[model samples]
Target: MSIRPIEPDDHAALLALWRRTPGLRLRPEDEFVPFCAYLQRTPGLSLLCERQGRLLGCVLVGHDGRRGYLQHLVVDQPYRAQGVARALLRRALEQLAGLGVQKSHVFVLRDTPESLAFWSAQAAWEARGDIQVYSHSEESP
Candidate 1:
């Protein structure tokens, strides 16, 4: 398998992957226009893993000049437990560090047991009990 930076052309394939992945939650930001805009906003930070030109796994990464955010970390079911996710994460963090981003966060939904387990097993990541996240949507008054 090989790892590479995500390009605009990969969006369709990625969407298919995300759709099939059980635990992923897609939002408006995942649509084509916003996805491309995000790529433009933070270039070379998102990535994919593939073999023989087939998409195996992917992770979306970006930073706000202070902290990095990771999203949509998914691997094909057949490819799980093979270290694909870890490799993607390591590479993502390395890229963020290169951009002087020292800290990163990934928000996993409480309903996704598989996702929770995967993150819980990550030795380098810590579950934050001291902080709570609140989000406001523009669509919501």
Candidate 2:
């Protein structure tokens, strides 16, 4: 498979991919616009993996000038276990390091066993148990 940076044009295909993937949760109310803004905020880190002109995987990585974050990572079911995820991650980490990111983090939902397993296998991934993660919606006060 060939890997490259995700373009604005890839938005639709990426969204569709996420829809079919099990672990992803897409937001409602014109989420694409916000996603575009995110791309503008952190460019060149997101990536797509494809073969024979068909998208097979994607990795959304970015940083806030200090800490790097891997927001989304998914490989087409057929492409799993064939190193696609690893390649995408390796590329993102290299880019993050070049951006001067001292540390990186990724989230694995409690329900996604595959994702948890995939990240757990990586030597660089440190699953935090002592910390609590809290998030709220934009509509929340």
Candidate 3:
């Protein structure tokens, strides 16, 4: 698969991809305008994998100067076993390193067993076996 920077125009394809992919709870397409905006602001950090013009996978990476965060990693069902996600991750890490991010983190949902196992198998440093994630959305009261 050809790994390349995601374009603002790719948003539609991504929405369609996310709808078909399991293990993802995506925001409504109308609520996701910041995607390409951030990708434009950060440049090169978010990427997509395609082959023969078919979308295969994608990853979104960003940082706060001290550390990097990865999100929205999804692979086409047909491309799962072909290393598309791995390639996207490798490229993201390399770019994050170049940005002077010493540590990188990925937030995988507990409900997604396949995603959890996929990330755990990478031997993430420390592999936080006992940590919990807590968050409150802006709409939460």
lDDT of 3 at 44: 78
Q: Write the per-residue lDDT of candidate 3 for residues 1-141, one digit (tens) a residue.
A: 699988888988988988887888886422457776678668878899999999999987788898888888999888897888889988999998998887988888879999988887786535676888887657635
Cα lDDT of all candidates, in order? 0.96, 0.85, 0.83
What TM-score, computed on C-alpha atoms, does each candidate reach? 0.97, 0.93, 0.89
Q: For model 2, state the Cα shift of residue 41 in Å.
A: 0.8
lDDT for 7 in candidate 1 is: 95
lDDT of 1 at 57: 100
The Cα error of candidate 3 at residue 24, in Å, is 0.4
Error of 1 at 5 (Å): 0.7
Candidate 2 accuracy as TM-score: 0.93
lDDT of 3: 0.83
Clash pairs, model 1 backbone? none
Question: Whose lDDT is greatest here?
Answer: 1
Ranked by lDDT, top first: 1, 2, 3
Kindly list the per-residue Cα lDDT of model 2 for residues 1-141, writing each as its tens digit. 898988888889988888899977777622677777778878878899999999999988878899988876988888888999999999998999888896998978899989989988999788998999887777745
